[model samples]
Target: MLKLNYLFHNENLAEMIVKNWSYDPESTEMFRYYRISSNAIYPFRKDGRTQLLRFAPVQEKNKSNIEAELAFIKYLRENEYGVLVAVKSNRGEELAEIRTPWGVYYASAFVRVPGSAINQTDLADEIIFSHGHALGELHRLSSKYEPEPGAPRRWSYIDVLDWIDDQIKEYANAAIARSEVQLLREHFADLPVHTRNYGLIHYDFEYDNVFYDHEAKRCYAIDFDDAMYHWYAMDIEQALDSLQDCISEELYNHKKHCFLEGYRTAFDLPEDPDAVFPALRRFANLYSYARLLRSVAEKWDHEPEWMQHLRTKFEQSMRSKSTLFGTKLS
Candidate 1:
């Protein structure tokens, strides 16, 4: 979530971003805050078409990261993969930077995908199948993608593990979390890597980042913010992680079977993808624990009521995951 101070002053900066894109003036009137975590997103109608403006503080994201993200999106589009395309500003820039007294903010715009997001309650089999196929197709394309010269590259999974260690090392549970991080780093180091089984991955390929177009019978993926270099099976594991909480084990097993079946249609699978999931789940847990800790650790004078409630929720989650990791590692 955005800090209280930034939220208060975001309106003027948002207007500046819209104008830089040369969007219709009415877009400013339609601007509505959509999300606040990791990035601040606003959805608005641009000439009667829905679009989104996303910006993040330099501390969270930098100009080079945004440029690399858009470049990958362009590559995916060129390869006929279904993904959101970035919108260029009037200055012919895919990413725009605004200097502020608080900090530098990088902004980018994208055409809002034209489909409803799927959730746990009403996830149909067809959507589940297409979800797997969509990720598989992306991995296939990623294997062949080479960034243009002088373009920034996405971070590797090990780089993120190092980051999580640095960010959370001072917290109460840092020792246990750091041990798990070391174990994960060593395990991945020993694993074999090849273009076919490892490449760029959508680190958060869950239902929220994907949309199903009913008429077209396809899935469009958004939010490449967490894209990174990792094993392809790690993507499948992350996509299936949420199902464990909401469904019976039998049903989860059935869904996994269906998902992998669809995945095989687009990309070849590792010989034992199932065996790799337990370690990957540990990685996922540690990463989420670090992010929640950071959110709860920030200081705000006169914090909002919602933030208090959110902080309580985050604390509960932190304790739960901390115990879970301690048990798994021990």
Candidate 2:
């Protein structure tokens, strides 16, 4: 989450950032302020289509990092992959760096993904298959992707583990957390890496970030914010885990089968995909735990009732996850 004070203090910041883009000034008032999480989002209308303006503080993201993300999107699009198309700014730049009183921010725009998020209650077998196929397609493209010389690249899974190690010191149980992260580092290092089994993957390939197009019977992915280089099976594991929240045990297995069946149609599954699930789950849990702790540490001035409630909820979640971090993570 961004600092609430910074966001509120700079009342005109969003407007200033919007000007860098090629959006209509008249529609500025109609631009709706979306939620702030990893990034601040604004949804606006243009030429009868909705578009999104996303900006993140320089401390959390830089121009190079944003460019690396866009490069991957461009590659996917060129390969006929169904991904969101990035819109260029007024100066024909994919990224705009704006200097504000609070801090520097990198802003970018994209055509809003068509269709809506998959409703967990209404998840269908075909949708599950489409979701799997989408991820497989992304992986297939990711395997052959290579950044041009001197271009920035997305961080690898090891980089994220190192980030977790650095972030652990700020937690209340830093020592214990450090040990768990160390164990994860060792475990990940031992995992075999072959071009066929590992590469960049859409780390957040679950239902929320994937928009389902009922008319085309296809799924389009969004939010590559968390994309990183890792075992392809980790993406499969994470997607399956998301179903646990909404469906029953029986249905979960059935859905899993359908998903894999669809996945195999696009890309071959590793010899033993399930073998990597445990470590991947631990990685996912710890990564989220560190992020949640950081969110709780930020201070808010006259925090809204809802924000306060969210903070308390995050704290409770952290407490529950804390126990699972040390010995269990090992």
Error of 1 at 202 (Å): 0.8
TM-score against native, each model: 0.92, 0.93
166-271 in candidate 2: lDDT tens per residue? 8768667678767778888888888889877999888888878888888888888898888889999989988888867657887988988988988988998987
Q: Each model's number of backbone clashes?
A: 0, 0
lDDT, model 2, position 244: 73
Pairs in clash, predicted candidate 2 = none
lDDT: worst 10-residue window of model 1: 1-10
Candidate 1 lDDT at 164 equals 91
Q: What tens digits encode model 1's per-residue C-alpha lDDT throughout 1-330?
A: 343345443676777666767577766766554677768887766677888888887777646656777889999988878888788878888888877655787888899876767563267778888888998898999889888998898888988898899988988758888888888887788889999989888888888888888888888899998888889988988888854654578789888877787788999886688888888888888888888887777667887887777788878987877665644432
Model 2 lowest lDDT segment of ten: 2-11
Model 1 stretches with alpha carbons more than 4 Å out: 1-9, 245-250, 326-330
lDDT of each: 0.79, 0.80
